[model samples]
Target: MNLPTASRQDGTYPRPQQLRAHWADLTGVWSFRHDDADAGLADGWAHGLPDARDIVVPFPPESSASGIDEPGFHPVVWYARTITRDDLAVAGLGTGRPRVILHFGAVDYGAQVWIDGAFVGRHEGGHTPFSFDVTRHVTGGAAHTLVVRAEDDPFDATQPRGKQDWHETPHEIWYRRTTGIWQTVWLEAVPETHIARLRWTQAGPAAVTATLHLDGHVPAGGSARVSLRFDEVSLDTVEVEIAPPARRVDVTVPIARLRNGQAARELLWSPEHPRLIDATVSLRAHDGAVLDAVSSYLGLRTVAVDRGAFLLNGHPYDVRGVLNQGYWPQSHLAAPSYDTHRREVQLIKDLGFTAARIHQKIEDPRFLYWADRLGLLVWAEAPGAYEFSPTAVQRLMREWMDAVERDVSHPSIVTWVPANESWGVQHIADEPAEQAYARALADVTRALDPSRPVISNDGWEHQNSDILSVHDYEGDGAILARTYADEAARRRLLDRMGPAGRRLLVGGAPDHGQPIMLTEFGGITYQPDTERDDSWGYTEAADGDDWIKRITALYDAIRASSFLAGSCYTQFTDTLQETNGLLTAARVPKMPIEDIRAAVTGRRKQR
Candidate 1:
């Protein structure tokens, strides 16, 4: 995979949207051990684990990259690392009284942190970012022992584990379990009271909004100063006053370039343009002292579903997308490295896909960053719970909100998928409680980020959705073409269609004028090189040429249908036990890149 060197490979600036120059990337080697019997806490392992072996940080022990390729049922894992003053200095920190904030990009299931053996903080939600201010517990300018205990129960069906398998061995769709830290770990230096959360959105075609959530109540004489820049041209800065006790402040800035009416469309963000405007926002006191400042960026765009079309930047867009589960052959879910994200995005685009569904996983932020930078649309979906219960919905809500809060600012994310195939609410086809649960997911995601279109449930049984997307694996292109030949035929098909030919929607909502697309189809399994036990896909192809033929035919079916405005192919890469990806698990293209591109774009493959 001829991937170029990735920036921030050492994990510096893990959170690019809220970047700080004075930060440390604590993501290399760490002492690791597993507590299979769950006796570490009682045995005082927080101070240090006995007989611990070295394991790579940010990659779970279940993965090969972590140097501990043991895929056993160790629910409890422990990790210890030291952060030194020289480490901080190398990260561009100076001798100062700034508060030290420890940031974890993500940890699976549950995480508890201790600084120098003193409990600092604990957080739930495996795929969401969290942090703690360890300044009070740390020794000034000295090395501090940081210990983390992570717990993930494989048999916990109420948890939103995505594709992580519960059984001893991965089978069918489920893969290996990632029990602990699976993303970057870093630290930052900030003021006593600083920006805790920053979000950006398109307020209008001519303006954008920035919302900053403060760590504490607004101090007296508090004001937020914001400056905007487009293509290197800085615009006038704006400042807004915040009253006492107001923890959140929303500031809107009129984009000067977007305000230019006729030429404004040139600055609009799309899969073709992908124009991002740089921004620097600061929290200042009336005395002109900076309390907190953050540098960020936003794209000027609008996404909507209207009259049987998916609109991007207020214009209809052909969503040639592929479902990406965010897995790897080595690292499971943790992107093997940051550069791997760039290569994935480039490969998706190279195959003529304008978007990625980001199926199931919330995805690494760096992947979204590259999508924002490299002109590709994204549908950010949440991991699903396997069972339905009050606990399940509660878990789903907490993590879904965290996922949205962490990823809402990205310009590449144009769609929000709260559920896929109704995994947790499996009985939504009849049960009111299950139906309401599905609706709540959509409502919550829309409530959080109202800018993007929300698909309540992708694949089937959508109660309230801006677009209706169904997953069908019918391989015969001619039958697909005929089923979608007309509006009446499409409606009849949807009324009787699910991924496996079940009911598609509740409340008879198909009459509503909204876009409908084949979100998952054409899983043509073709591994001409390797063999596996019970490897499965929707359809089986003979060889490389047969694979290309089936791919082109499937794409042609979708393109030939006038009403099917958009489509997402079954997947991007071959995951474990699933051999139906345009590229292999190692990210090597299955066929010629150009041939795949031709098929993806509805063009005939050259002889």
Candidate 2:
């Protein structure tokens, strides 16, 4: 059976800076073969795979969208597709001696790319984007063979696998494993000296700072100019001269100057009013001719933590959030379409959630784009490995750094979570090395992007964390109310049994000043399909009305706590057999949306 596909636009991936660059979508069917024996390399399979089966690009073989529909273990897989000269020509790569780059949105575990049977590059880290220049490997008017090898070991604890099931079948909380490509694959044409990266920051209430990284070489006396806009209205234009061997340039634009003495707050961004500003950057030759141009956007906002409260734009903001796993029933990690991202964020907002903790996964940039446009706060999390080893630490650190660098410019992402529930560093509280690693991760995150708060080890272990967060699954509201009635009482409880009774704090003295949040709770399971014996939830609800009552009570308990800044409900949608979600796996509401919204927003009480 075929799974439903998402509505995709022409150019959906590579978000944050949706540049107006020459590009082509390399999705759809491709030749596929399972390298069970791992003999593709010795077999010279990169040259061709004529006997291979057909599968869709960007969707893993385990997914129905790939046309494989086999969820069993496949350690190694190979994909082959032919890129014709027309494909390159359409992307402006056929002439002008432009560089042709092949971009892979994400590949599972490990990936190797070969062009025209020549090894181009290899990349590790399953959930990050990687690219290679294939200009030299392809002829201008001829077809070239593109091949990829993906290797994944789901049982290997050294790699960050998130919730991918290690067993042959789905179990407990883990779901089916994803293998091979699971995101968009595309091609782009760029000048030899092109804009490599664009990083933006709100310098102050009145200005935005943009840092540009250039690749290749720049001729002497070349220059670059940036044009700023707000809602299509011209803001300001800044220019900078570039010398040969130059790579980095910084430019700041003052909004007041663009608004003709208007205050910066006139165009401030908030959840209630998501205002975005567009920017276009152009590189020029000494003769003032435009060599390259790319388009991007930014939202003007600031986030801070002050006195046990999360502040947005200098005002205390309560984070009514849900734990979004970023999983789909059919596509697994990949969204069915770019529109699905917008709809999901809209659903969260419609359900009265102001924020969402993208739990245990580095989500797609398109999803973050919608979050920014729709004004939804996000807690970006790094997927965790199950074991504590040197390899695990290295992999986690590299991928986490990549994730942070890729998402730092997004205004919707207010927080960074490096570890969750002590998944990888389980002995962080007892082992000095683990504690050091966790602290190092937190430090690295802050060093890369200090504007946002970092929850070092969310849901327990309180080492080097900006926010004091805990996860408790107790179903009783009275218990939650009594446990966190006051800061003194909460500290005493932490001293006695530690957070979650696991000794989350090393010295037993909790950080009194940091904001406290119930990061995870209220996993009341409601299995609408009672006939499925395999389905399960964290805690069973007696009925729909009982579920509402229990959920409302938990929200009330959270609101009543003097020390709590906010809370995140267990999850947004169900996945696999874990049916503890406000929305079912198919994105259907299990209960009245208004009732849940009332409970979450604290507008009404259940009699």
Best by lDDT: 1
Query: How many collisions per candidate?
Result: 0, 2
Which one is best on TM-score? 1
lDDT of 1 by residue, 267-343 (tens): 77787887777777888887987777777777778888888999887778999999998998798889887788888
Question: Candidate 1: what lDDT?
Answer: 0.84
How well does model 2 score by local distance difference test?
Answer: 0.83
Worst 10 residues of 1 by lDDT: 1-10
Clashing pairs in 2: 6-336, 6-337
